[model samples]
Target: MNLVLWIFTGLLATALLVSTVKAFLPREKIAATGPAAEWILDFSPGALRTIAGLEFLAAIGLILPAALDIAPILVPITATCVALLFVGATTVRLRRGERKTAVGDLVYLAIAIFIAIGRFGPWAFTS
Candidate 1:
């Protein structure tokens, strides 16, 4: 279980950090962002950047607390928040007629939820 957590932490963190960096980069640097990223471009730059920043923070939240053994309860809370973010992402993707992207969001949402449940219950860390 610990190994699984570490895996998820690394994957999720890398993904989120990359996304955050991409969001801040110039439009030309992101010439081939997928349909979802293109859709995000439709919104204000601030909005897009905010989402990216939140994701980056959530990624850190997924790992830092548990890794440091300080306020480890935050792991579950962060996972729950990430799941909620993906729920919103899924909704937006569906609304944009992006079935594949929406499905991807659903997958992420599931993983985040799983982490939340596991960290909160069966795999909870001890003080």
Candidate 2:
């Protein structure tokens, strides 16, 4: 279970890092990408950047403490935050009638929630 959690954590963190980079692009550039990126137009550039910054932090938080075995409780806490962020993302997608994209957001949310539960429960590193 621990290994599985680590695998998922790494994958999620990598994905967030990629997303953070993309989010940092110019708003016009992001919005012009394609249908998958159309949602970028809904948010102000600053807000988009802020969201990206949080995701980057979350990615780091998910990995560093656990890997270092120092303040490892942060892994679950960060996972919770990631889940919350996905909840908001899913809400936005739904509100925009982007059901297809919303499903992807839900998948991320589920993964985050699973990590949070595992880390906070029997598979906890802090245990």
- When summed lDDT is taken over every stretch of 10 residues in candidate 1, the lowest stretch is 27-36
lDDT by residue for model 2 (5-73), tens: 999999999888889965658877877877767888888888998999999999999999988888999
List runs of model 2 lying over 4 Å from the truth.
none
The superposed Cα distance between candidate 2 and the true structure at residue 122, in angstroms, equals 0.4
lDDT leader: 2
Model 2 steric clash pairs: none
Per-residue lDDT for 1-127 in model 1, tens only? 9678768767766666777875667654464565556665556778877888898899889888988999999999998998999889888888888897788788778888888888888888888
What lDDT does the true structure give each of the candidates? 0.80, 0.90
The local lDDT score (0 to 100) that residue 62 gets in candidate 2 is 99
Off by over 4 Å in 1: 27-36
